[model samples]
Target: DMTQAASTGGMMEMPRASRGQAHLKLAEFAAKQLRGETRVASFSLNGWDTHSRQKRNLGAALERLSGCILALKQGVGPAVWDKTAVVAMTEFGRTVRENGTGGTDHGTGGTMVLAGGAIRGGRVYGRWPGLEEATLYNRRDLMPTGDVREVCAWIMRGITGTGISDLETKVFPGMQMAQDPGFLR
Candidate 1:
């Protein structure tokens, strides 16, 4: 019944055939949100390893990510999308410099993508740690100029009205909430 489940729940009507299974599921989740059945959804897309052939491998992964975001927006409709915040983050970063294999090794600083109408879109946030060799972390990775947790804290504060004390003590332990970056509308 797994296949049946995948094709059900508003999946068959997905406008884009190129979307993968994960994107279909995300679209279904967005439909549920539109119906007030749920307020949150979480899913993951794999194939981001990119130990080599980064240009081709990473490009494909990014295409799938773009499709997933589009599916979410299309499923939710304009009204719900205006209240949605889609946060995409990787657990780890890659080295600033390419390696001998034409790929990057695991490193420190990574990028987080925020989309949807709920976000303060069209602007990149965070301090720029230049790619200069001297500014690299341990001379290997990009130096983390800001904590990812702080950005998430501010988003949580904006979306849910969560207080700073709880964000520090409970939600994101050991994180010192910094100045609000106004990530959300």
Candidate 2:
């Protein structure tokens, strides 16, 4: 996809390729199986490395991301959309400090976004770690107090009826499941 094309074009043509192709491909695959209820779908679009021209790269990434979401919504029918859920995330985030070339370097603490009618929409979850001295990780990156494993546990229990004990003992050893508050509608 976009990454492939962008790479072939030496980085300038990445955003030129359509990001919505992934969603369309998924719909095609689902249709072949005659599936009635598709529960989940995940996708990732890269090119966030803004070593130069940060604004342009960010804009293109946002546009492509938006297109992908819209296409996915249209591909999946309304009935399924009402029950389905989409969760997007990145491995990590970049540093707060802009580099000399108006770019960002690898850092800690990325963001996760959830979308769909099943989600409570119009609400941002998670605690915001204020950007300040003594708050950064190793005095350079954002501190991650929230363990992602706990979030995964909640989703497994609530969505698929996985037992908390099993998740704690098997999936993530020694993880204490806390109150997830039913993120799904």
Every candidate's CA RMSD:
4.8, 7.5
Compute each candidate's TM-score over C-alphas: 0.85, 0.75
Model 1 ranges with Cα > 4 A deviation:
1-20, 30-34
For model 2 the TM-score comes to: 0.75
> Could you give candidate 2's per-residue lDDT for residues 1-185 as a string of tens digits?
32222112331112232554654454344322222333443346766777777877978876666666666666665766676556666677777777888877888876776776667778877887778968888777777767677776777676678998999999999999888757788
Error of 1 at 92 (Å): 0.4
Which pairs of residues clash in candidate 2, taking residues 3 or more apart in a chain or in different chains? Answer: 137-141
The 10-residue segment with the lowest total lDDT in model 1: 1-10
lDDT of all predictions? 0.78, 0.64
Best by lDDT: 1
Q: Return the lDDT, model 1, position 70.
A: 88
Worst 10 residues of 2 by lDDT: 4-13
